[model samples]
Target: MNTRTGKVIVNQTITADGYSAGLDQTEEHPFGDDGGDGWGSSLHSWMFDAGEENRAEVDQINAASAVIMGRNMFGPVRGEWDRQWNGWWGDNPPFHAPVFVLTNHAREPQPMEGGTTYHFVTDGIESALKQARAAAGDGDVSIHGGATTINQYLAAGLVDELRLHIVPITLGAGVRVFDGVPPRKLEQVTARAASTVLHVTYRVLA
Candidate 1:
């Protein structure tokens, strides 16, 4: 009953200062030290703990057939695939569909539980997007991000819909969303205010 076209979409959770991540992201600190102890507990508490409260957005994210994410969002690995790092998500990840990771380092496809397979793309964003769209079919293709990745798609004018889960806090100095993206007007489609976050959806006008 959830048949949808394969529209390229972006969904990100950012702070009030527009940062999706803070400085010093490591294997231990996925989101880095955002003026907190680490672990990004506050920035991502809505997904980790209070999932049901944000069920609508959560479901929307999960409904995607394929996902494309930056290397940082995939894990803390850098340079080459020197280490045996599958991803931050242990054996099973939240995304049950095929996930294409944007990285210069090439690695073999790593399959995980729940039908999720991680494909390492060494080409570029366009190549990764092409693969994602092919895998997505009639379902949506989600551009999962950590700011930098989304900026590339936004810069290339590829994204169709933008969904931002804006948290109440500010990071002061972190990797902000739309850091180098060119200006563009967004058509607001829907908005919902929850206890901790304000979810806003926009149609990216060409």
Candidate 2:
């Protein structure tokens, strides 16, 4: 029997200053500015530029059975879905599992190649989590965030494990993690250092 023993993991890549993204997010700059090059150049270089060095972390990121992300993380589209936007990833997204997107606007379930599907939840975060948990079963439900969404989960004490990929650079100001989250104790689970990023896992203590 498949046991639903998987955790609700919040996996994010943040700057040294705790910002997950920079200001003025646009279609051209999905991840916004990184102070240096542009967009995800500084914040996400660890995954792209140094993938070999962080292969284990990369694999763990995609190992989730289901994923939940905010509408902004889904795409640049805003306010009632003016146009048809699939997602940041192409036809075959990396998740390769069910993805529950938190959005105020309702949308039909978008099925993609390689077993990936996007299910928009108009209800709320808890509702989305319930659906993601059902879809995940024995696999973990990964909270793929853009800071705001992660902050909500954190504030609500819904996250089980918090996995952070800390980059060296700083964004000064932007969408940040733990912006509205209340104080909580976290037990360090594991920590690893790569060439470009440091991966740290923490158990959200109750």
* lDDT values, one for every candidate: 0.90, 0.92
Q: What's model 1's TM-score?
A: 0.95
State the lDDT of candidate 1 residue by residue for 28-109, as single tens digits.
Answer: 7878877565688888887768898999899999999999999988888789888998888789998999999999988899
Cα error, residue 173 of model 1, in Å, equals 0.8
Which 10-residue window of candidate 1 scores lowest in summed lDDT?
33-42
**Each model's backbone clash number:** 0, 0
Give TM-scores for every candidate, taking all chains together and pairing residue i with residue i.
Answer: 0.95, 0.96
Clashing pairs in 1: none
- Superposition error at 86 for model 1 (Å): 0.8
lDDT of candidate 2 at residue 88, scale 0 to 100: 82
Best by TM-score: 2
Q: Could you give candidate 2's per-residue lDDT for residues 1-206 as a string of tens digits? A: 75547899999999999999898888988877767555688788899989899999999999999999999999988888778788989989998999999998988999999999999999999999999998998789999998999999999999999999999988888999999888999999999999879999999996
Model 2 scores a TM of 0.96
- In model 1, the runs with Cα more than 4 Å from the true position are 1-4
What is the lDDT for 165 in model 1? Answer: 94
Among all candidates shown, the one with the greatest lDDT: 2
